[model samples]
Each structure stands twice: as C-alpha cells, then as structure tokens.
Target: MFRFEKYNIADWFSFYRILAVPLLLAFVWYGERTLFTWFLLVSYSTDAIDGFLARKLKIVSARGSQLDSVGDQITLIMGLIGLIVFEIAFMKANYGLILLAFIPYILQMIIAFVIYGKTTAFHTYLAKTSALLQGVFILWLLFFGPVYWLFYTMIIIGILETIEEISLIYMYPHWVKDVKGIFWALKDDRRTIRKKTVKKNGV
Candidate 1:
C-alpha cells in the first residue's frame, strides 16, 4: 500500500501541502490563535514527511521538487506576514524593526528567483536548513513572546546562508550544472531499478 508509483499517492501529499496555505491564512486572519498554531504545526510536519517519502520511495521528480519549494515558501511568507501584522496591530512593536526584518526576507526570495528562476535554492542543503530554522524561529516568535537575541541570531544566520547560496551560483556556475547532472543520474538509477524489478517478475 505504501508502494511508490510515479504521480500517484505520493503526489497527493504534495498537493495537500499546497492546500494548507489557504487554511493557514484563514486561521490566522480570523484570530483563531489556537487553530492557527495547530495549522502551522501540521504544515511544518508535512514538509518533513513529503521529503522523506519522496526520497525513500524513489518518487522524487523535478515537478515534485518545484511544488514542494513553492508550497514551503507560501506557507512561510504568509505566516511571517501574519505575525508582522499581529505585532503591529496588537503589540505595537517598532514598525521600523519589523520592516527591517521584512526587507532581507523578501530580498532573499527576489534574489533567488532572479538568479535561479525559483523562490529558493531548492537543491542546497544549507538553504533548506536555513529556511526550516527561519520558519521555526518565526513560529516561536509568534506563539511565544519576542526572544530578541534568538530572533536576531536567526536573522544573521539567514543572511549568511543566503549570501553563501548566491555566491555558489555566481562564483561557481558549474554548481547548478552539477545539480542537473545529479538529477539525471538519479533518474538513470531509478530506471535501472525498474528494469531489475521487471526482470525479476518475469515481465
């Protein structure tokens, strides 16, 4: 039942992740803090499950990767925007500081898209970890109170991570080329496995 069939059950999980964005927005917009928190938790959990299932089940495809990246960004951006609006509306925190935090965050997305034609460097482990940590940190700040030191620490780390990723694209153009090569290699490996399975089944 858990078998990986290309564009089958596994793809539904990807679609579910995408669908969570609107539900998350609704919860936050309605000021249902409890419901919003639960929604965020579930959304973050699915990020891990989707990646695990894709890799372990050998269902990783370019389309799946693209969908996953877009979904993650949408979830994160909406959450951050909601938190910022909440802070301004309720807590009356410094508008300048919030705007300061927002500028770099939006720049990261813009730069990635302009450079890589995507919202993120989806293939980079550091990029992924940076995004995951940033998401967690943002959620922590929203549900809990402001941990100023922790928030600033994550912001710094995020800036460094973005710089490192962009540098790779500029300094080593071949790095992205290498990623394409890796994808082809993975596809070839999958094809080999299918062939072996077919032979064993006497097809």
Candidate 2:
C-alpha cells in the first residue's frame, strides 16, 4: 500500500491528506481553531484536486482509487475530530442527530469490509455529492458555527450516499472502483468479465 514507486501525481495528492492528519491533530491539541480550519480546508481542496487530476490526466487505477478513498476517510475523520474538539458545545447539542445519520454510514462501512475486506472505492456520483456537502458543512461550521440548514442538507445527502454505497456493495460480488452510480453499476462489466475469465480457466 505504501509503494512509493507506483504512485502518480494524483496519488501523491491523496497521500498528502494522510500526511496532514498529524498536523491537523496538533492544531486541535494546541487549541488553534483558525489554523486547523484553514489546514482542513486545504485537505478538503486536495480531495477535489486529486479526483480532477486522476480523470484529466488519466492516471486512474484500482490502487489509486483505494488510496483516494483512504485519504478521504482519514481527512473526514480528522475534520470531525477537529469539530468536536473546537466546537464542543455545538457538537454536544447535535450529538443525537449526528449519530442518527452516522449509523447507516457505519453499517455501510461494515458491509464493505465484510464483502471486500476494506472500504470501497466506488466513488459514485452521489458519494461525491455527499462529500461536497460534508466539506461545505464542516467548513461552514468551523468558520461560522453550526447552521441548521447546511447541517440538514449534509445529513440527508450523507444518508443517501451511504445507502448507495451499501447497494453497490451488494451489487458487485467482487470489489470495483470508480462506479458512477446505480445506473452505471447495473451495466458494469467488471463482474461478468471476471466470471468469464474464471470459467475460461476452469477455476
């Protein structure tokens, strides 16, 4: 997973977020909310940049997809930690609501791990939209405290994205990456191609 020689520019961009985790945590530990927010913004920006580079530069790969997914998960988790630490009162006030939205997400992760032994890298359209909403909400909360409308939007989109992920997990018996959405998943040849290859080899 840490094979540096195999990584491309987009992969490196994804890797940067993982590297930034400690710095983000230190900002929280030192009680530097503004600095943490700015750095977190950078992390969020990289998420967009890496995907653009991956598609534009045509550097997409299974390993790159996995790396990007890991980076996204780490950055988001750190962002949440930063929020809880710096915005304790706000988080506490909305803890139950947050957990209610998060339960399906947790279940989605469990389903992916059970099916693929790791988090998925489907990167569907809904998932991308959900990530955008999450970043917007996080930045808004950090810069302007909690906003109810943004919070509601983020939660709703998140639940939808998690449902889509769960469906994709069940749809693809083997792991896949970069599926656009359910419609695209329905037509994907990855599973059938693998089955054909296996049968061809009598495996």
Candidate 3:
C-alpha cells in the first residue's frame, strides 16, 4: 500500500494525472472528443502545477520525479490516442512524417531503458519545451484543426530533444535527474566524479 501520509501536496497533484486516466479513456470510448481534450488539458495543467509546488515547497524527491515522468508518459499516450481517434484523417496524411519524428524518441527510450533500467527524469529545459509545445499542439489540433506550423515545430523540437536525451545518456553512465541540457551536463559535478573514479580505478 502507498504511504499516503508520506506523500506531500505536490505529489498528490502528480497523482491527480494518473488517477484521471480512466475518465479520459472513458470519454474516448464514448466518442466524446471535446470532453477528452478538456480533461487532457487539466491533466497537462497538473504537470506544471506539481513541478512548481515541488520547487516552491522544496519537497522534490527522486520518487516524485519518477512519478512525474510516469504521469507525463501516460498523459502523452492518452493524448496521442485522442488525436488518432478524433483526427484519423490528419494522422493518416502525416503518418510517415509522424513516424519519422517518433521513431527517434522510441529509440532514445530504448537506449535509456537498457542503460538505466528505467525511463529518465532528467527534465531538461529542452524536454520541458518539447512537452509544452506538444501539449499545445495536441490541444490545438484537437480543438481546431491541424496547424502545420505548430506540428512541424513540435516535430523538430521533439527530435532535437531526443538527440539531447541520447547524448545525456552517454554523458552520465548512471541515470541522473533534473539536467538542464547539454551545456549544463558538461559542467555537472557528477561527470567530474565519474572521471575521477575512472582515473583512480585505471579503467
């Protein structure tokens, strides 16, 4: 059983997204596109809220980061399902480009899992920008129609973020969290520690 007592307020906000998945799915099942999209917006909103509260309240933890990533993945998947179901024509039209953009992300995920035994929670600035744009694009596409500019922009940022994630994976052999980006990682003490250890071990 989860120790609810130990979970802080920000953690509860993170929990809100996971707990709301079923309702979003139910809306999807019933062909309620608007309802699903609206609920998804709320879910995405909680992502920002949780992160802020975690920072302001100074209750951040490894577990919270893990939960945040899990919630994010679930929300993104649900959003994609919504887009596919509601915008089949758009998806069909851009399936090739979509796959091209998504394949790198899938590959990056595979690399992370193989190396770290879990998905990363680096929360790099690029990752945050990618997520923000993605959420906006999905919501806009669902609410209005496909905006080619936004779609293409999301694709490019997403690919760049994937490349950065892959690079970070190699930079830190062990998983680390809250990395800002490549430049920040280069200056991170963890890299120095690893190098010193490697030198001491002569390996």
What is the lDDT of every predicted structure here? 0.64, 0.91, 0.92
- The top-ranked prediction according to TM-score is 3
All-Cα superposition RMSD per candidate: 9.6, 2.1, 1.3
Q: What pairs collide in candidate 3?
A: none
Q: How accurate is candidate 2 locally (lDDT)?
A: 0.91
- Model 2 scores a TM of 0.92
Native-vs-model 3 lDDT? 0.92
- lDDT score for residue 116 of model 2: 92
| Model 3: per-residue Cα lDDT over 59-82, one tens digit each | 999889988988898898899999
Q: Write the per-residue lDDT of candidate 2 for residues 45-150, one digit (tens) a residue.
A: 9999999999999999998999999999998899899888988898898998889888888898899999899999999999999999999999998998788998
**Once superposed on the true structure, which residue ranges of model 1 sit more than 4 Å away at CA?**
1-10, 89-101, 171-203
Residue 133 error, candidate 2, Å: 0.4
TM-score of each: 0.69, 0.92, 0.95
Off by over 4 Å in 3: none
On the 0 to 100 scale, the lDDT of residue 72 in model 2 is: 93
